[model samples]
Target: MAAETAAPAESARTWLVGLVRRTAFAVRAALSRRDGRATAVTVAAAYLVAYHLGLGHLGLRAGAVVSRPRFDLVVVEDPVALATRRVAPFQYEPVALLSAGPVEYLFAPVNAVVGLALAGLVGVTLAVSVVAWRGPAACRIGAGAGAAAGLPGILSGVACCGPAFLAVIGVQASAGLLAAFRWFLPASVAGLLLTLLWVGSQVDPAAAR
Candidate 1:
C-alpha cells in the first residue's frame, strides 16, 4: 500500500513540476515582445487605479471646494504599526492622508504593495492570453480565456467593498457570507494564477517561436 501511494504521489509531483516549467516557458515567450510589455503595463496600471477607486482609497471628495491649489500629506503617529491595521477584509487602514485639490488619497503601504502585486499578476495573465490568441495561428486558446482573466479583478473589486457593496445589490450579508470576503483576495490571486497556467499550457512552445 505504501509503495503504491508513493508512486502516485511522485507521479503527481512530477506532473505539477512539468506544468510549472511549461507555464514559465510560455510566459517568457508571451512577454518577449514590445507590444506584450505595453499591454501588461497598461492593464496593470488601469487595474491598480480601479482597485483603489473601488476601495475609496483614491477618489474625489464630494462637496469639496478648493480655494487654492495645494498638496498636503498627513502621516499618522506610529505609522509603521498603523499600516498593519486591517480595516476590513483585505483592506488595511491608511497611515497617511494625501490631499490635492478635490482629490483625496489614503496611503497605506501594505495595501499599495498588495494592490501592485495583484495588478502585476492580472496584467501578466492578460498579456499571456493575448499572445496565445493573436501571436501564432498555431497557438490556439479559448476565445473567452482572455476575457475570463478579467473576472478576478472584478471579483476583487467587489471584495474590497465587502458587505456594503453586497447590500447595495440587495443581498443580505450573513455571517458566513461575510466570512467569505476574507478569502476573496487570496482566491482572486489563485484564480489569476490558474488562468495563466491554463493559458500557458494551451500554447505550444514551438508555435510561440
Candidate 2:
C-alpha cells in the first residue's frame, strides 16, 4: 500500500516537471513569432497604463482648463531611498512628479518596475495562449485561458492601494483585512505562473512552430 501511494506521487511529480518544461518551450516558441511579439507589446503597454492609472500614479485633471500644454518633472533630493519605501501594499513612495498638459503622474520607481514586470508576464502568457489558439490541433488551447488568468493580476494592481480601493468599494477596512491585501500581488503572480504552465503544457511546441 505504501509503495502504491509513493509510486503515484512520484509519477505526479514527474508529470508536473515535464509540463513545466513543455510550457517553457511553448512560451519561447510563441515569443519567436512576429504576431506574438506584437500582441505581447501591445498588451503589456495597455496593461501598464491601466495599472498606473488605477494606482493613481497617473491621472487626468477634471474640469481643469489649460490654455496651452505644459510639462514639468520634479524629483525629490533622495529619490533612490524614497523609492524603496512602501506607501501601501505593493505600492512604493513617489520620488518624482510629472505634469504634462492636464495629466499628472507620480513617478515611483519600484512601483513602475514591479508593474512593468507583472504586465510583461501577463502579455507573454496571453501571447502564448494566442499562439496555442491559432496553432494546429496538437498545440491548441482555449483562447480565454490567458485572459482569465490575467484578470487576477489586474485586480492585484487596482488593490495595491488598499484603503483607497476599499473606500471606493464601500468596504470597511480592518487591521487584519488590510494586512491580507498585501498578499494580493504575490498570489496573483503565482496564479499567473501556474496558469501559464498549464497553458504551455497543453501546447505541443513542435506544433506551435
Candidate 3:
C-alpha cells in the first residue's frame, strides 16, 4: 500500500528527468551538425573553463595576489586611505557580474533567478561542448564532468553568474565561424571572449556602487 502511494511521485520525477535528457540530446545534435573545427574549439573551451575553475578552487584571488610596486615600493597601503584614492586597484570594487555591470542589471533579483539561469547555462554549455567535440567517448566524459561541476554550483547558486553564458555564446559562434574560416575562427572566438571577460572584470559600472 505504501509502495503504491509512492509510485506516482517517483513516476513524475522520472518523467521530468526524461524530458530534460531529450531536450539536451536534441540541442547537442543540432549544434554538432554545424562545422569542422567546432568540436575541437568547444572541447578546448571546456578544458580552459575547467582549468580556471580548478585554480579558483585552489583560492586564487586578486585580493590575495601580492602586488609588487612597478617603479617604487610602499611597505603598506591602508585600506581606508586607498578607498579615497583615485583609481585604486581593481578588486577594491564589488562586482555583480564580475564587479557588476549589464549582466547584474539585467539579471536583477540577481540572487535567485540569475542563479537558476547560470546553473542552466553551465549545464547547457557542457552539453554543447560535448556535442561540438565529436567522438562518443570524449563527449560522454565532457558531459559527465560538466554535470558534476555544474550541479554543485547550481545547487549552491555559487559562481553561477561568472562569464559562463558568454563562453557558451563564444563556443556557438566559434562553430559557425570556424565552419566558414579555417583555424582562424577558433582563435578569433576565444580572443574575443577572453578580452570581454578580462575587461569586464577589471573595468567598472552599475553594481551597487
Arranged by TM-score, best first? 1, 2, 3
Off by over 4 Å in 2: 1-20, 61-67, 136-155, 158-162, 205-209
Q: Compare candidates 1 and 3 on TM-score and give the better one.
A: 1
Q: Which runs in model 1 stand beyond 4 Å of their true positions?
A: 1-10, 61-67, 136-151, 164-176, 205-209
In candidate 3, stretches whose alpha carbon ends up further than 4 angstroms from where it belongs are 1-4, 35-209
Best by TM-score: 1
Tens digits of per-residue lDDT for model 2, 1-209: 99999999999998787787777777777788777788799988998987887788888766545887878899999998898998777888999989888898999999888988988987887777666566533235555554554555455554565666678689988999888877877887887788787776666545544
lDDT of 3 by residue, 42-132 (tens): 5435543452342132123333324432222122234344433322111122112221211112111222232333333444444443443
> What are the TM-scores, per candidate, against the unseen true structure?
0.80, 0.76, 0.23
Models, CA RMSD each: 3.3, 4.1, 18.7
Alpha-carbon deviation at 73 in model 1, angstroms: 1.0
lDDT of 2 at 146: 47
lDDT score for candidate 3 against the true structure: 0.34
Could you tell me which 10 consecutive residues in candidate 2 have the lowest summed lDDT?
135-144
